[model samples]
Target: MALGGNPIFNGKSFRGATQAPRVPSYPQSQPGYGQPQYGQQQYGQPQYGEPAWSTQQMSSDQLQQMYKMYNRPSAGPAETGRMTFDDVIVKTAACLAVLLIGAAISLFVAPGTSSLLMVVGALGGFVLAMVNTFKKQPSPALILGYAGLEGLFLGGLTRFLDALYPGVGLQAVIGTLAVFGVTLALFKSGKVRATPKAMRFFMIAMLGYLVFAVINMVMVWTGVVNSPFGLGTSVHIFGIPLGVFIGLLAIGLAAFSLVMDFTSIEQGVLQGAPERYSWTAAFGLTVTLVWLYVEIIRLLAILRGDD
Candidate 1:
């Protein structure tokens, strides 16, 4: 739930580098002396109106060196420079790979479905998620650590649920992928957007969801509700388990969270943010997708319970 409807996106502003001073623009033709455009001037060129004797020229090597020094790619990719799509993709892949490995370990090594490991993973993942989220600068190690911890939690939880529901984990995985693919396609096509108004609504709804989640968790912990899912399964709306609706709401929130992530990454790239911030982009996407998967699996579990 940490990534669910986040008020603060890992998409924070990075001020390490600013766009180069637009490679000083020089007029191609001045009113009096027609000095060629900034880089257009060659080794030996006199102003259009200048006398031949007045011409002062430099060597071709000098001109080329000056041009390169002045106009070469000012943005450094390896040096906290502008981010690219490749940076984001590669970083995200690394995080997901770590997550998968962690999941495999938990799934294969856990003894008779241990909730202890799940709890540990959940707690550790939560802590790391908070750390990485709030940090001003993105930390690759911390983000990857969060991924692994989250994966452990996921693997344990999936095993537990699948044991009861049988094949539900696979179903949930498919569902999560479907939602993600659909959301991404819609975003790339510009069919759906996170507008200002939508964002306002999102904030309000997210606040309400957080309140509900906190209350439910408290109810469960305090034993005010005996049900495993607390209020989510205990309460009903329109003869349907309240959790069904709540899970759907959570899924919607997660989907929008993705939209926000995508929008932020788009802005970051367009604004020429540092490539190092790709870790930031990767982190945001991982958070949202994990939330999405959790919601999907939980919803499926709720449905199976109802049946």
Candidate 2:
């Protein structure tokens, strides 16, 4: 599988799934077996020692019909019910729309209510992300549900942060879109790729980042750090918050992750993966974009806080 970086595509197989079945050919008759002998009956008749064989002569209309059928183009991915770029785009748009709706709902609610929902969204989204990740097949409902929960979390978080730093949410959104667009363009242009070496590095960096995030969360929970972002804001590297560097690295990783997503999606379409798997591709892209958005917003917050 060329999908080493993204766990969502790791175990799925698309080999020969949408290929047309081979047409079987009738065996040609041997010279001695089917040929008329000196004392045998004519064609289409049964001889004394041979079985009867019937030959039907087709009319001109029937011959033309057969010719047309033989010359007709083979079915495409859509006709065969296989995956395509359009399917991925449509499904991804649906997921994003659901997410936006959920976000709008969260933003319009009361602050206290929004905070409560944010917590619920965070926990629920995490659960759904795990479930969707491990599922053998994609479930549209569950994937959309996950997107909705993530939206709630993001909306609440943005509301809280944007209150302190006005326009930061919008900036984050723009930054996320810019990064996504650039990454996609690069991937499409073949200027960037998710090579095996890069993927290995990505895995290592991701693992380290995860560990740091867990430790930071633990510190915040234990009151080990008084800063809102824990070490991210509390520590500085020559007048720059440590988070700025970490955030940049994280954003780069997320961008590269989009490359992997694109690669996997392109390969899936080419390999004729089932149309349902487009939802899986959509889910993966959504997950990456969300992470990118959060990182951008957090980075913006950290920078604004220093000012």
Candidate 3:
């Protein structure tokens, strides 16, 4: 059964999925990062006839306090070093600005010859996406490359859709922005979260959706589904294309995916994750927003095609 939508794989890590940088552990008394205080005895060192600090000597309160002090801080807007939601927003906006520039060029200058650009964009984006995802050390060059490729793809796609429905591209853009805004608002308001059960459901649904999409693509490639939209157009319920329903589900999943992204960033900040992990958080968010836009555009196309 289709569960609630989530990321492509929940338990299995993506090859290039960025992770928060690990914070270096330090001794309890150290004032700064990763240095033992001068003349301090190492943990578990034996003292002459004195009681050794051990698990037995620590009270529950002391242990809890220690954990609290050392525990990572939450990812908040104004958190000290951790990546804030504001950082993610800024990066995402920068990406969209690049995308818009590319779209304008494709729409006005190049006109109908966007297929090549789309193919190039998709391939380039995939390569850069993988590089950024798997990179232990984040490179600004690679990250920007990924953004540029994505812009190309977005530009070509927008131009193609605009040619078909005239105003549909704008509509889709508005819808995408609205969804993103609402999702962010909800996240900030604490109305939604990446709870264990919801996350589990999201994982299950994502796997099933991926399998279905793959199968559908294969069928299309093999000429099994004669329709232009593969199984989406041909398979309909009550005169509604299957793709329509699926797209709606996908949009919902994307929204929830944003929530998860927010949660992850939040956790990272709260945990005092290293600052470099901000790039990772940004990448994750960009991936989700791209997915959301794709779904919105596709849905609009399906709707316009029906009419």
Candidate 2 per-residue lDDT over residues 1-307, each given as its tens digit: 2354698777788886767799999887645875766676676666586645322556778878988999999999899899999999999999999999888878999999999888998999999999998898999999999999999999999999999999999999999999999998998899999988898999999999999999999999999999999999999999899999999989999998899899999989888899989999999999999999999999999999999
- What are the runs in model 1 whose C-alpha is more than 4 Å off? 1-11, 14-16, 21-80
RMSD of 3: 11.3
Better of 1 and 2 by lDDT: 2
**Whose lDDT is greatest here?**
2
Sort by TM-score, best first: what order?
Answer: 2, 1, 3
Candidates in order, TM-scores: namely 0.79, 0.87, 0.72
- Clash statistics: count for each candidate: 0, 0, 11
In terms of lDDT, model 1 sits at 0.82
Residue 305 of model 1 has an lDDT of 92
Worst 10 residues of 3 by lDDT: 1-10
Once fitted onto the true fold, the runs of candidate 3 whose alpha carbons sit more than 4 angstroms away are 1-82
What C-alpha lDDT do the candidate models reach, one value each?
0.82, 0.90, 0.73
